[model samples]
Target: MARASVSPAPPRVSAPDLPRHLKRVEPARGADLLQATLHLSGDVDLAHSSLEQCLLTADAERVDLTGATVLDVAAKDLRIASMSLRNAGIRRLRITGGRIGTLDLSGSRLDELEIRDVRIDYLTFGGAKGSDILIADSTIRTLDLPQAEITRMAFVACRSDEVDPRGLRAKDVDLRGLDAEMFTDANGLRGTTLTTFQIQKLAPAIAAGLGIQIKD
Candidate 1:
């Protein structure tokens, strides 16, 4: 997947602490959007398309962008039942204020992405590769990351009922602000950042993984 020569690559996100509430410059309210392509303005089936520097806001039951190469896009207030970006290459994308039943990014390559204020029932990154991704101020019912290689990802002020992290290859994945009920593979959390309080809260489960029993 290739990005346009006009759009520069985002800087690398370092370890330990991640920037909070980072945002791009949004277009002025009611400004002429003729320059910016309004994707999903007409067709919903945009599979295998190369969409660049677009703006979209919609309410749909299902929207598919499978195998698409999306770059430098800003979307807001998207209410969808299911949104799929499977096997796609997405870069420098921002999404806010959305409610989705399911968001599938499995087997995709996501870079420099930010998703905030969205409530997703199921969000999956299975078998995907990602970097510099942030999901803040979101409520997700399930976050599936199995077999995913992710770098510099953070979940700030987010809550998830379940996070399946089996076979996860991660670096600097901050979970300090995430309140997750379960992690299917506790050991898959290695090389990720977690606050002391979070680790203490999961002490029992961690001990159980090591076959250590604590008597009450």
Candidate 2:
């Protein structure tokens, strides 16, 4: 009496033609490099790639990065000057220890976006619509969220000075950090979190949202 046996399936591989100076990329359907310098042209979609340390500097029109998981991807030294992300979907994005200079994410959507230990000079999340955006332990110079609609956003342990929210509309915005004085509100500060000392930094125009009169 004999029995039948079965073999396991081998791993899937799609090798790429790497450059001599720069390494080649054999990117998976939703998985990619851990650390590499990538140069792209046209629409680049590395969605759901668990990128560790990536250096991406491109002038592409639409970089389709949706539903991607970014861990420890440092863009702190990226000097794109001014870049735009249009109609791109960003979710579950985790950034740590990076330098971002002038990033404009208008007309984009973010879901569960988490940023930490980063220093951004000029960042604008304007005209963006999404939820659960957490920015913690970061230092930003100028952040403009004007005309942006956010849901369940949290800014924890962040230090900033110039935060412009001319037409900012948020739901459940949390500002729990040492430097929460930089935040100003025109619409209001309802469903927001802050300490008593942090609330003292708001001006008459900004404090109107919280129904508090500032003494000049």
Candidate 3:
């Protein structure tokens, strides 16, 4: 029995080794993809363009980055369904492999992001903030971090059922790849970093939501 982790200690996100021979884009005919690499299909509208070191690939069913200003972009092998970066301003982004149903960054402003081996159904970083973020081997069904103020996010070998961290203020988050069942507001998981079998399997639903009575 050697389980040590007084939380706070997860911020080594890595994934943004760009540059694999670029130059080949098509910003909906309005050209200009920084360090280019995009191959469009259907809908696209780089709203208030200003991307840098960009790189997006393959198909696109819909996309309208409202107030774009992405820096160091990357979305390899994309096959988007609906992407609406409402109030975009991302920095150093990276969205790996394909498959996205809906990704709506509400009032965005994320910095240093990463989403490897994707397959998202619906992801919404409601009122985003910034810091080092990473989500590896993803497979999210619905993950909406409402009022997000991310500091240092992390989720390796990820998997989500339907986790909506209400007023999420990730102060060095790292849920040990929780693979949640469901959670709209488990106190927004304070300042994450779970492991100890994931807090003993969520400690009986977090002690029945804090009513506390574990004497069964």
Candidate 4:
């Protein structure tokens, strides 16, 4: 894990009290983004430019931006409520630290996406297509994996809100450091793709699928 070189540190605050709707504007071009720290109080818009090591601390609101781009933006140790990325042409976007309420990734494409040391409530990968999706040391509320294709994926030290059978879809899926409830649907369970605890959690669903009734 590489440390961010942009801003020294974000503004430290105790929780937040914001309205339901909030918006703020910040330009990515010529904003000293190389080592710049942005203290966002409400919704933030960071569109356009080459931002490397830029830190954004928002009030857990939706981050809306489009058309702007970046080369290697390392966002670490920041709290964001939600993020709305549409028509963004970004590459090598690494998200680390902080918790997002909802991450709506619709109509956005990326390369080499890595998420580590973050806590998110709802992660909607719907209509999102990318390569090399890796999630590690994170807490996910509900993972909606539909239409999002990945060549390589890994889930390490990760916890989910619910064991959604439809929450998983991948060509090469790696499940390690996971809980058993991640796979409760017997029919949707893949082959040889679970750990000991996971197997124990899905045993009842598997038995029920096999028409076996336990005599309590």
- The TM-score values for the models, in the order shown, are 0.81, 0.61, 0.33, 0.66
Q: What is the lDDT of candidate 3?
A: 0.79
lDDT value for model 1: 0.77
Which stretches of candidate 4 lie above 4 Å from their native place? 1-25, 28-39, 46-60, 66-70, 163-169, 180-192, 206-216
lDDT of each: 0.77, 0.59, 0.79, 0.59
Give candidate 2 misplaced runs (Cα > 4 Å).
1-80, 178-181, 184-188, 206-216
Query: Which candidate tops lDDT?
Result: 3
How far out, in Å, is residue 108 in model 2? 0.8
TM-score top scorer:
1
lDDT preference between candidates 3 and 4, better one = 3
Kindly list the per-residue Cα lDDT of model 3 for residues 1-216, writing each as its tens digit: 999974566655445556677777667523346777767678988777777787777587997877788888777868889988878888878889899899888788887888889898999988888777888888989999888888888888888888888888889788787577777667788988777876776787688888888995
Q: What's the residue-level lDDT of 115 in candidate 1?
A: 88
Better of 1 and 3 by TM-score: 1
Clashes (N, CA, C under 3 Å) per candidate:
0, 4, 0, 3
Per-residue C-alpha lDDT of model 1 across residues 45-129, encoded as one tens digit per residue: 6566665666667677777778888777677888888888999898877888979888999999988888889999999999999
lDDT by residue (tens digit), candidate 2, 1-216 = 686532111112111222334454644436767656665445556655555455455544444444455443333333344444444565444555656666666767766666667777877887888676767788888888888887777676788777777677766666655374456564545445667666656655555766787675
The deviation in Å at residue 213 for candidate 1 is 1.9
Q: Lowest-lDDT window of 10 residues in candidate 1?
A: 26-35
- List the lowest-lDDT window of 10 residues for candidate 2: 6-15
